[model samples]
Target: MEKRMIHLDETDLAILELLQEDARITNVALANQLKMAPSAMLERVRKLEEKGVVKGYSAAIDPLAVNRELLVFIFIKTKDSFANDKSARALAAIPQVMEVHHIAGDDCYLVKARLSGPMELMEMKRSKFSKIPNIISMRTTIVLETVKESSHISIEK
Candidate 1:
């Protein structure tokens, strides 16, 4: 899909803020909160979706509940071209890989992964990451504690 810029008014920002806070909010409830008609609210949400603003709704799960207690950030340096590298795609393909970003400076990519424990991390490094070609070096940092981690963004009203 082609990405294009879309101008947002105060209402659009309000809608985004509410959705970010609680995506499961019904159209009627949302419209009530915004003091707008339900049909108008629905249309706004539809436009947001069409513009790729509201990508998709998802259930937020607790990592600890799922036995994924360890959060590790790995900085990967590659010998291959940084742009459109197959290694980055391979890293992203891993089930445990939560986020992958092409970064500047020494590292080509910064990868975030959640694991059950250190053993699982070691296993992943040995079995999965080691096999990806052009990986010159990988530096793993285990997060001892997360002060705040959220996908939520504050939209100005």
Candidate 2:
């Protein structure tokens, strides 16, 4: 895939840093911090959104509280060639599957999934994964502990 570069200035970087720190920060508050007028701040943020710099805002939920204590990374080998993303799309369609990446190496895809427990994982393997076409094999690795997990990206000048 081809990459596109979007130009960003110091103000844009500042806005990104603040937004990354707290997405819930109000437009008025964000403007105040940077000493920018609320309307100006809004315009800049909107332009960033238009450029695809700011994807979207979302809340971070606790996995344990939602009965999704088990986190697993499943490496999948598919029968399809590199040009095909059908298997990857199918895996991503599963609600339990949080992320699916078309990968390099022996495996065709890397899937990050959240499940209740071992029994749930087994059930998913049998009921869910078995239905996806072209999936030849799957090797799952369960995460015991997560020391650091964040989606934040630092914006440097």
The C-alpha TM-scores of every prediction are: 0.95, 0.96
Name the regions of candidate 1 deviating beyond 4 angstroms: 1-3
Model 2 lDDT on a 0 to 1 scale? 0.93
Residue-by-residue lDDT tens digits, candidate 1, 30-140 = 999999999999999999999889999999999999999999999999987845679888999999999999899999999999999999999999999999988999999
Residue 147, candidate 2: Cα error in Å is 0.5
At residue 72, what lDDT does model 1 achieve? 96
Clashing residue pairs in candidate 1 (N, C-alpha, C atoms within 3 angstroms):
none
Best by lDDT: 2
Estimate candidate 1's alpha-carbon lDDT, on a 0 to 1 scale: 0.93
Clashes of each: 0, 0
**Root-mean-square deviation of every model:** 1.5, 1.0
Clashes of 1: 0
